[model samples]
Target: MASTDAPPLDANRYRQDFPILSSVLHGDQPLVYLDNAATTQRPRCVIEKIVEVYERQYANVHRGIHWLSDQSTDLFEEAREKTRRFINAPLREEVIFTTGATGAINLVARSWGDANLQAGDEILVTEMEHHSNLVPWHQLAERSGCRVKFIPITDEGRLDLEQLPALLTEKTKLVAFTAVSNVLGTINPVVEIVEQAHQAGALALVDAAQSAPHGRNDVQAWNADFVAFSGHKMLAPSGVGILYGRASLLDAMPPFLGGGSMIHRVTMDGFEPAELPAKFEAGTPPIVSAIGLGAAIDYLEDIGVDNIHHYAQMLTQQAHDVLEEVGGVRFFGPPPAEKAGIVSFTLEGIHAHDVAQILDQYGVAIRAGHHCAMPLHKRLGVAASNRASFYFYNTPEEIDALADGLRAAKRVFRR
Candidate 1:
């Protein structure tokens, strides 16, 4: 449960923190940014931190004894600590830095899949996963002689949890799925999924790319074996993401990349891997981006995640009601309060690309396409759809802008 009585988020004050939001995209109209599912605008605090790191302390981390290198290394490790605490992980050693969510999931599949999976083993995933979550496992199955299984999704976009009992078995090696569907905005029951996976002697990996932006994520509470998310979607810079694995699991998994910092000792015969996180993080990590992520986390903490969740729910509910009244729009997702801030819908007799273009002309930005979940779209029997995803900084007025844009799109395309 989340607290609703918290004071209003001071949107005006918070809006000031993101300077780019004030900039005009078409030189006249304000940018009604609804494409948060793709990437979020960075706050001034995060930008400042990135600039500060490069200007004040720019050096290669982990090998130099000089002052600048030492300082950079300290700041980078501090960022890792911030990530661990943000997710409520029991140990900082469990956090591994990667390029983004996609890279992190690939790391898991490559390392753990190679080490543990044998011929005829099965990996279970869901239909609502982003391509990042699905492709790696598919590739792993191809290479490791493993098979992939999918959990079906209902027409309303919820996972058919009742089917899980039959899906899990002793041969199941891993169960990887998204915490929330990026396109449908479906919030999966992660705890129940984890419990079911463990019951069958399988590990669980959660793709938290969509959930982390709108709410608090406690890896311990979910008891997930591994969780991955992107920083850019959570108000930080692009090119940096996190992978949180239980310390023991990460300790046993082999290194994903073989290079510089991940080696404790190099021999002519072989190279010994470094400790827990370093073992997985090869080469020079994204130092400045990690610092930016730390600042972004601090900014979110100041605003309070609970308030962000409430604000998003209010916005989505308002849009749902308006879109329902419009009569031709069909929305996909869990009911308003039960999901994240994303809303995906398709209008009858209107192509998604045309609708998006018309919306852009009105200074309203929304995502339009398969949203990287092509299987889910195919399951839903639609070629594509338009999505309007919200964040803490978005206002109710923007929702009205989206509605007006949709109405205009309908009129323009009604030939």
Candidate 2:
């Protein structure tokens, strides 16, 4: 378990480290960034690391015999090591890099799902899953003739763990779920769910895109079979992510994408796939993006992820309190105590888009609409909701600005 005893974060001071945080928007308004669940702003260290890579050591990895290739390969593999430690996976070889979390999920769905699942086999996913987690399995089901089942969500936007038992059966081959809901912000019990999947004789896959960046993440502690998260969500550049599969499972599964790097030997008759990670990481990997993720991990480690988690929680609760004071704001998802630093709400008699536009006028950034979880939004009984997600760099004053923006939006809509 992650220690919650770290010193609280100092957002006021840390804000100086992010270049984009110093920007002004819409004339004179300061940019109040609250859309962290979508993506995070990069620190100067991470940005500088990317620039250094491009200027000094940019080259294709593991292909050429030249010195540059060796240098690039070393850096690339070092990034993989950083990812392995970041999630506390037992083996570095278990970590596979891909385009993003969506790509990782798709790789698992096609590579493992196609090989293992049969016509009567079942894939269990939660209703609050982002479309990336849902569509991959659905596609796998369509191809392999397997059945897809949903673990329902409660009225409070939490997984109905009581219904989980009835949902799992012998036919269930895999249980894929989100560690945290992108829309609802509900933090699901990853360890508990992984254990349940094991008991039911099914493999477990966790979509950690939302939670991995915020707190301590240990795949061994969770006893999970597969865990996936994106670099962009965690302050790295876009287009790079991680998939950590148990070595035993990965060794048994075939490669998802076949290309030059993923093959050990290509014959006129057939081709043999490369070992553990390379099997999934076909073609050239995202070299610079992976290094950026490693740098981002370094930045987070220095500050302490537990501290980030704690302060984000404080900001979340503050948002709830201030938004509640701003009447007509109906919050979705569990109360602040039960969730992370995400507050999704719908203002009475106002469309989410209009609210987002009004908030932008005040230079407050927030997300509006289903937020890539259409089913979760439908469960909340709203067409769309305004989401204000906080990170460790956000300040209390920004939450106040969010409330002020909502008040302004309400005044405009009421007229």
Compared with the true structure, what per-residue lDDT tens digits does model 2 show for residues 1-415? 1224543978988999999998999899999999999999999999999999999888999899898888888889999999999999999989999898999899899989989988999999999999999999989989999999999998888899999999999999999999988888899999999999999999999999999878988999999999999999988999999999999999999888889788999999999988877878888899999999999998999999998888888888888888889999888888887777899999999999999999999999999989998988777788899999999899989999999999999889773
* Candidate 1 residue-wise lDDT, 230-337, digit = tens: 999999899999999999899888999999999999999999999988998899999999888988998898888888887887778878988787669988877988
Instruction: State TM-scores per candidate.
Output: 0.97, 0.97
* RMSD (Å) per prediction: 2.0, 2.4
Clashes of 2: 0
- Kindly report which residue pairs in candidate 1 clash with one another: none
Candidate 2 vs. truth: CA RMSD?
2.4
Candidate lDDT scores, in order, read 0.90, 0.91
Clashes found in each candidate (C-alpha, N, C closer than 3 A): 0, 0
What lDDT score goes with residue 251 in model 2? Answer: 95
